[model samples]
Target: MRNHLVPVTAAALVAVSSFAFAATQHHATGSVKTYDSKAMTLSLDDGSTYTLPKSFKDPGLKTGEKVNVAWQQSGTMKMVDKVTIQK
Candidate 1:
């Protein structure tokens, strides 16, 4: 039973680690369509929206601002790791 359990545990660990590695950061550039401070979300012109993590500082962004965003996806939720507003 212990032998069987070892493989199962190892497989589970590998699966979890693979999932973590797969959630690497990605970049997007677009004009902001909307920014909801209350909801902590920003929508881009390319139709991609990101949820800002609470730990992330406000970039003083506004609707229609062009931006470059670094984000990560965990399941269905998209979280912004960093954002840069374009001039």
Candidate 2:
């Protein structure tokens, strides 16, 4: 029982740490290479892809437009919560 305690505790810590990292919100600015309203995905000119939230409102995004994306990582996907077009 004592030997099993350490590994279990370590596993719990790893699980918590993974959620902590995932909760971190990230921001990026780039030119829009493509925007798919139906698919709800945004691709930057630099090759980074972000998935827009389902309830997200359109910010009048267009190809070649500069935007600031606020997103969070969910598993393998970067989910965008907000988008601000740059003047």
Candidate 3:
């Protein structure tokens, strides 16, 4: 029984580790829908919208433009990186 339990525990640990490895990282890429500098908002071309943080300080983002949004997980999700005005 002790010998059998060792293999079973090791197998279970491997299974759990595999699940963690398969987890998806945070990422999203889409065209810019709307970027309101005053409103601090960003709307992607994918019919999705996100509000920019007040700390965000950049330019050259406009409506109907292309953008690649790279975000980080913060409870919900927060934009940590972005590439705007891309083809």
Candidate 4:
């Protein structure tokens, strides 16, 4: 009886942990499509568009720049976290 109870508890814990892990939350990636001295427009690979704030996009990005961007709600909104320029 004790052995059976322990196994059940462990299984419950495992299931809860899996659920928690899935709720960690994450953002999608985006890329730089156009840039200028003040701002830039980023296009996500998921076919979404986002505008980078002037404070962040100032001096703009180059063409074909890949950036680490986070998206909200099916890639509607995006914010660039990191930019990696490709040759």
Q: Rank the candidates by lDDT, best first.
A: 2, 1, 3, 4
**Alpha-carbon shift of residue 62 in model 2 (angstroms):** 1.0
List candidate 2 segments past 4 Å from native: 1-19
Query: Per-residue alpha-carbon lDDT of model 3 for 1-87, expressed as tens digits?
Result: 998999999999999998776453455678776677897767777776565677887657776666777555445545445444567
Residue-wise lDDT of candidate 4 within 19-38, one digit each (tens)? 77744434554566555444
> How many backbone overlaps does candidate 2 show?
0
Off by over 4 Å in 3: 1-25
- Stretches of candidate 4 off by over 4 Å are 1-26, 36-40, 57-60, 71-87
TM-score of each: 0.73, 0.76, 0.53, 0.36
Residue ranges of candidate 1 with Cα displaced over 4 Å: 1-20
With a 3 Å backbone cut-off (N, CA, C), the pairs that clash in candidate 4 are: none
Q: How many residue pairs clash in each candidate at the backbone level?
A: 0, 0, 1, 0
Better of 1 and 3 by lDDT: 1
User: Which prediction has more favorable lDDT, 1 or 2?
Assistant: 2
Worst 10 residues of 4 by lDDT: 70-79
Instruction: Identify the leading candidate in terms of lDDT.
Output: 2
**Superior candidate under TM-score, 2 versus 3:** 2
